[model samples]
Target: MGRSPCCEKDGLKKGPWMPEEDQKLLAYIEQHGHGCWRSLPAKAGLQRCRKSCCLRDRQVKNSLAS
Candidate 1:
């Protein structure tokens, strides 16, 4: 299998996530859950890609649940 197209830079945001991005993602997941990771970024209005969002979810989710 090959890497996802979403993984490419594609001019998407990179580096550390801003507070607003984390808030938006958390809020969206709280309201609707992360049904489709591939489309979650756009729906949540985040500049990150799917993988970034996935990683963010893990980071935030783990920290919160711990």
Candidate 2:
């Protein structure tokens, strides 16, 4: 079976996120316990997919570890 694409790649920006973006995402998740990832971009005001956010964090952590 094929997997569904995560977020809408319309006008959303994708790349290495800035500190402000990271702060906003962290604050949003802290305030709102991560409900629907599909709708998270709108709610959290982020241009990234929920999966991308998670992957970014993991990548950062892994890089730091090594």
Candidate 3:
């Protein structure tokens, strides 16, 4: 059988995140810490998946390196 989707794709945001999204994610993480990626989107009020959040975090970290 095919792998199940990590999260519902409907209405979920894809591609690069906006500045406000970055702020929301960062703020949520700061306030609650990284509890669970799977649940973080709903908690953070973002329309992304756990993997997307992780990638966004990684992207932020990489950007900071330069």
Tell me the tens digit of each residue's lDDT in model 2 across 1-66.
Answer: 787676566877777788887777767777987677767667888888878877765666587699
Q: Write the per-residue lDDT of candidate 3 for residues 1-66, one digit (tens) a residue.
A: 998776567889877689999999999998999889999999999999999998888888799898
Report the lDDT tens digits of candidate 1 across residue range 1-66.
967566566769988989999999999999998799988999999878898899999999899899
Better of 1 and 2 by lDDT: 1
* lDDT of candidates 1 onward, in order: 0.89, 0.74, 0.88
TM-score of each: 0.83, 0.66, 0.83
Cα-lDDT of candidate 3: 0.88
lDDT of 2: 0.74
Predicted candidate 3, C-alpha RMSD: 1.7
Worst 10 residues of 2 by lDDT: 55-64
After superposition of all CA atoms, the RMSD between model 2 and the true structure is: 3.4
Candidate 2 Cα outliers beyond 4 Å, as residue runs? 1-8, 57-66
Q: Which stretches of model 1 miss by more than 4 angstroms?
A: 1-6
List the candidates ranked by lDDT, beginning with the highest: 1, 3, 2
